[model samples]
Target: MSKRKAMPSGGSTAVPTTGKRAARPSFEKPRGFFGLSDRATTWILAAVLAVWAGALRLYKLGHVKTLIFDEVYYVRDAYTLLREGHERAWAKDISKAAFERGDIDSYLPDPQYVVHPPVGKWVIALGEWALGADNPWGWRISVAVLGTLGVLLLFFTVRRLLQNTALAFLAGYLLSIDGVHLTHSRTSLLDLILGFFCLLAFYFLLRDRDHFRDALGRNEGTGEGFGHVTGVRWWRIAAGISLGLACGVKWSGIYFLAVFGIMTVLWDWTARKRYGDPRWKLRGFALDAIPAFFAMVGSAFVTYVLSWSGWFASQGGYFRNWAAKNAHASNPVSEALLSLWHYHEEMYSFHVGLDSTHTYAAKPWLWLLQLRPTSFYYESYTYGEAGCEVEKCSAAITNIGNPLIWWFGTFALLVTLIVAIAKRNGTAAAILSGLIAGYLPWFQYLDRTIFQFYSVVFEPWLIMAIVFVFALMLGGHAASRTRKRIALLAIASLVVTMTLMSIFWWPLWTAQVIPYDLWRAHMWFDSWI
Candidate 1:
């Protein structure tokens, strides 16, 4: 074969140039829509997640026909909102008939003034509206749906973080089996809504990271030392909104907004450095980080205020007109808004100083081990009453987590902290930060009467931390097949253990009619009972 004419000494060779390959597609986009491609494997995993989350959230959803725990508060508040334009007080017996015959008018017309924001109550109202007034299922259905969505969001979030389908599924599976999550899902509670929003904010921030990095990689000008990209990331904006909604659900969510916002900015700074930018640190802060802070935190503030729409509109809400009556008045509307804010300040003060004794109060340090899970509902039943099967039976629903998951997961978090400090792994650091955002702040209130069940807000992130460490243990994709097998077996064992523990705890968490002896049998520790 005639070799291509060697034109000159420095001429291009025509021997097909096989040694130097064509530029490979960027590692940034690894298949699928937002990496979710039409691969059979992806579809199969999606189907599996759908079934897992659905089964956990939907099975025996109405087992406890009566209100359970916090459901009594949220369900009633929701019904009142549906009838009156604001929350109203209800008679003690109203819960018995409020669901029947649409008699929600048992509530007073004046605003009853609630501590939590109304968005969660509105969410609860959706189920009540759909199923009508008298159905317990109606009140709980929305929370169940939101809790299930949290699972799926968690799956996607972990999938993005770990870049492994198996690890993502492990996180989702652990969350599904968590007894606290199960109880919260079965009841109408604001914390579950807060949890869902927190997870969503995390998911959106992940999306923002991926998109921002992809944008940097694609911009040829960036290679020439561009200072910063001014692109408006819709994903980051959505994350801001979600973080705000989380805060609206509970003030604790502000911690997430603050931490994740900082986390995203740091991630951008690092991405810039990794791409060989010279002034990455300064430019990342001045251009990328500050704007991101505004988008996330500022937007969250606005969203949180918006959640008080009813309080703003109604004249009878507590403190709604305080500013008007006091010297703080500027204008009627402005005064009313200021008064509402003053009310929040007072509430915050109360929350911070709450050192009163409570039967189920727990220190933040003991929360990880569930040393004092709150008993949401408890009743001792006599034979032939309340479905008692023996001489004396018990029906209870405790907001406790699966012991295997919580204990092992907390232990895994300790390992993750060590690894992050020693190895400086970015993923490990990120997972730890999320857990801290949800948990560590509670330590500031150790003297306050915070219950262990409040840990539910951050429980999903704890599970994520566990899976993240497990992913690290599994080694990289190039690891030996034997190592991968061992990792899989270990993870499978953890899951199996968690599932069994969940089964044992299910009756107590759901108030099923079980013999008092059986209930006691499930209570592995005196603290748990």
Candidate 2:
């Protein structure tokens, strides 16, 4: 064989060598406690935002000084739940005037048929127990605290999900000041508690997603599937408990429980495939899906049953003796269980058959647009009355959303749905998933009398969708610095505008005295009245 010519030093026949830049590593998953980075900054910002939100909620919380709207039912029930183990019947046509003047003897001595479960009342009872039940501050304090904590929770959750501190703070701020959220926070109500628990459950599930992903990645290329992933999955169990608590507050939380359970299993399937398991589908089913049912669904069922402990432990609770009086009677435990099931059946029927008309009743489709805002409390004063200095003054607590946030956020939701489908983006898809869990279920009850405030349950998700749109505007790391700065400025302007809107609507949100015409100006739609 002929010998080949020797190549020159530092040069080859293949080509002249040229310097090439090393590729940067994939985006580093920031590390610290619970997947949060910039620990001091993140926590500091969170605490400040939480305090600000709490102050806004707590300000004038007792100034209304009386039960407003459903506060009559929930607040009174909360007090009775503390004193009596169950809600007692109220005198028919009870006088509100008497009840607000420290006359709480309106309840009759029999068990009242309550539509909602006891957990929400239990939470409210904490405040009533701590403070005096006769005080409005006591009635509303628990929900206000929950609402503030929800703002903080959203901040931490978004920060963990996107790993962006500024964006997370903005998300928290928007939710903190939004009109509907603010109003709910200031009032003694169950929906805010329901929203709080649902968001918490979602946060826990998000944490679990990462935990499972990291575990599976550690076992990369192992055909062992879930055998290596087995453990307590405490975060998932926590999510289940949160979901159950949410359901205890309202039946609507069942939608979140169902949707999140499905989403988690899908995540596991993707994780198995990414980890190089060719038999991912079957293995994921055998390992993840089956176990998840027990982990999430089973845990939720157990927790939900446990939440009714107060009702179960009490002999005089409504329907506690239904099974004893009927065919399902057995032992006391079995009778109580059966009676609870029967009570649930009755509640389901009542909810499904309800078609009562109300001034504030709104369709689900119109909720995104805020067409029919519910007036939780409204009072008109003549000039000098109630601290009013105008020709006509008004004090109101309306469940209207921040128009700037809701209207513009509607577009953001559309973008999220489109981006989710077009890019097959997991994060965008997850955002839409929460929105669906919160809002779409109401469409099934179009014939029922649902109010606009019910949208509070999913308001956090809507804010997340809006933030996702802002992320799209900010562009990727490869985008020019100038482009990114412009995007940031544009997003900042919108946020500032939302803040200004929050101020303009703050009087109505807090039931502060404002000119009648000003209140009218805030009510852009005739239906808002």
The candidate that achieves the highest lDDT relative to the unseen native structure: 2
- Using Cα atoms with residue i matched to residue i, what is each candidate's TM-score against the true structure? 0.89, 0.92
Clashing pairs in 2: none
Worst 10 residues of 1 by lDDT: 6-15
Q: Any idea what lDDT model 2 has? A: 0.82
- Please give, for residues 1-529, the per-residue lDDT of candidate 2 as tens digits: 3332332111112211222211111234434545555777777788899889999988878998878999888888877788778887777577355457777766778888989988899999999888877789888899999999999999988877676777788899999999989999988889989989989988998888778867765554454444647577889899999999999999999999999999888877755554445566898898888888899888889999998888888988899899989878769888999999999999999999999888888999999989988889989999779888988999998989999999998999999888777766667777887888999999888899998899899999899989888878988666899999999999989988898988898888888888888888986767878
In Å, residue 517's CA in model 2 sits off its true spot by: 1.7
Count of backbone clashes, every candidate in sequence = 6, 0
lDDT of 1 by residue, 1-529 (tens): 3322321111111222232321212332224445456365556766787788777777777776766666778888888777665677776766556645556567755556577777889889999899875777788899888888777878778877766666777788788878888888878888889888888888888888878766676664434444555478788889999988988788889999889988888888766655545566788988888899888888888898888787777777777778877789777777977897898988788778778998888888888998888888888988999778689999888888888888988888888888777766667777877787888998887678888877888887798888877876787656899998998888788788778888888788777888999988877788876
Please report, in order, the local distance difference test score of every candidate based on alpha carbons.
Answer: 0.77, 0.82
Which regions of candidate 1 are displaced past 4 Å?
1-40, 91-102, 221-224
Highest TM-score against the true fold, candidate: 2
In TM-score terms, candidate 2 sits at 0.92
